[model samples]
Target: MTKDELKQRICESVDRRRSQIEGIGDQIMVNPELGFKEFETAKLVANTMEEFGFQTETGLARTGVKAVLKGKNPGPTVALIGELDSLGVADHPMVNPETGAAHACGHNAQIAGLMGAMMAIADTQAGEELAGNVVFLAVPAEEYVEVEFRRDLVKGGEITLLGGKCELIKQGHFDDIDVAMMIHTHSDSTMKKTGVSTSSNGFVSKLIRFVGRAAHSGGSPHLGINALNAAQIAINAMHAQRETFRDSDAIRVHPIITKGGDIVNVVPAEVTMETYVRGRTKEAILDANAKVDRALRAGAMAVGAKVEIETLPGYMPLANDATMVDMFEQNSEELFGEDELTKVGHRTGSTDMGDVSHLIPAIHPMMAGASGPGHSRDWHISDKEMGYLGPAKSLAMMAVDLLYGDAEGAKAVMENHDPLMSKEEYLAFQEGVFRTEVYDGETGTSEVES
Candidate 1:
């Protein structure tokens, strides 16, 4: 069959299962689960893949699900990804009270759209005409929250890396995939029905703690070193460094105090804080991270307190493959229409897909379907057609365009794409970011590997 004919058949099949697709999205929205803990969501994805005669694998990187649809002959493997975890928005109407998890980021729509594409391709039996495999990936833990819990998981030997895609890469999950693509549902009004960006930022997470001797506030305030004061000093110092950050790097450092003290009546002996240092490039992120760490140490030194800083690896900067993006843009116009695609500049936000992009050719485009501020209580899929079926058609059409005939489209994309980092290099860089340093202010001493 012609490429357009195959895409048409897949789109028809997706349209036929419109109601089912909508239901899946809606059901998942109200029962959201947090990252690494997305058991139910993973189960649903695995069952759905099984229904389409694809033997699925679960428990990948804790709650990831993966299945492949083999074509008539293999040329290049393309991954169509869907994030399985939800943001922790306790106040959201559709939130799961037990988990404080909500689909406020439109991850539910991602899964629904992904399943729609998978169903359409499977239902139409387009694999016979295609030349490469299609990998449907339901990845978990895209949102980098619950850092403490994730750290505990790491210490327990449950998982080494934090982000789902990062951990999966460490586990060798993407070894067979040549290219990766996923559509993120956006609630922004400025976006068109579809949008692609040149790049996005990456980040590293820090868990900081200040320790001091506790003493009665009223009786012996002079005897106790206030940890809260140290934390406040660190925050202000970080703000001061903001002026030094280069605007071209798009550096961002925002810290929050997770714990102040045990009781207000006593001098604060412990203060815990968390922050993410994000930037458009790895070098920028590391530079900002070092400045933040210096500020933390300065704060502890000023107050004669002890500061413990733990740095963990986050996502890498995203570099969307040019050829793959061109293919997606073309398929989007053919499926939706011309004059509807949106071209955007580099984004400052971070995602695990960035890590995958550094390892292989990848695209993380946004599809306009949801409404309301992202990760907020009011965010939801506002347009069923655009939110549910648009991605389905767009993703499937892109796959068809790439895998049809001898798969020249996929070949061209791979030929033109040069991965930003080798797998070993990426892994080493991330592992190197893992560190713990304890600075004692009283003796002016800090211990680390240097």
Candidate 2:
């Protein structure tokens, strides 16, 4: 059997089960689960994988699902990933009643698309003609949940990292995989496209704490050094530095004062704040964080108070492997037609996938699934035009391309691959970045340092 024939066969097989795949998406949308807490969602996806005859592993990276399917012959191993967690978009019309979570980010669609590919390839009679191995992965916590919560999980031995796919990579879950593909569904246009980010921002998470003396507001206001006041001062300083931030690197520093103080009547003794330092490059992120730290310390000095900072390496910027992206583009056009596969436009977002991209050759593509603004309450799936099916088909076809498409595609992707930093080098950089002096929940003094 020819590669084109095999591709056609897989698409047809998945097309026949379109209804089942759509049902899976709808079910997950209705029962949305938050990042790192996708118990039911994981089970649902895992069950489907098992039905397809893939040997599965559960509880990876804390509630992740992994399945491996061996081909008729040994070749390169290609992996397809579907994120299993939803965002905390509570007001969304499709919010799950029990969990108060919603699929506003279109993760449900991603899962369904992954399922379609897994099932189709598993049932493909052309496996004898295909090359290498295929692995379908369902990852948890791609959402990058807060550091403190994730740290707790790590401390309790539930998991050792924050970002879902990063945790998996660290756990040797994908050590043998030669290629990785992630399809993120957005509620944008009708196009099915793949995007290559020349540069993506890295994130440094911090918890800021401020300490001050508390006294009755009305009776002894003069005796108190309001920690809340100090926090506001620190935030003001951060805002003022916006002008100094280099726009070329897309440096972004946003902070939220999570806890101002106790009762308003009494001068609060402590205030805690959470913040993210983002930049197009790790150096830019680190530089911006250094300025942030200086501001926090300045605030503490002005108020005659002390500040504490706790930091963690959130994620690294995503840099596409040139060869991998070129291969994806060619395969996309072949399976979906030139019209269907296009480049993304005016989009800016970050992902833990960046972490993997740093370690190995990877591709993250954007596919449309709905209309209107994405990541908002107004985000809704438009099933009329098979908006959902087109993207799902595109993703399934991408897998087919990687596993069975002309060997030239895989060869090109592999040839152009280069690691920005070695595993040891990257780990050393992260260890140096995830440093902090203080971490108090009440005082907003934690800051990501250079």
User: Which one wins on lDDT?
Assistant: 1
Candidate 2 residue lDDT tens string, 1-450: 776777787778778888888899889888888878899999998899888776789988767998877666667777788889987776888887776678777788888888887877767754566567767889998876556778788669877667898778778887888878877766555455444445567788888888889999999989987888888888998988899988777887789888888887999889999998988888888889988988887777777777887777788888776676666677667654686655543223678888888887787876655766877888877761244565556655665566564444555566778777766677677667666675233454444343
Lowest summed lDDT window (length 10), candidate 2: 439-448
True-structure RMSD for candidate 1 = 1.0
What lDDT does candidate 1 reach at residue 229?
A: 94
Error of model 1, residue 130, in angstroms: 0.6
What is the lDDT for 86 in model 2? 85
Q: Which stretches of candidate 2 lie over 4 Å from their true place?
A: 97-99, 189-196, 334-348, 384-387, 439-450
- Model 1 regions more than 4 Å off: none
Best by TM-score: 1
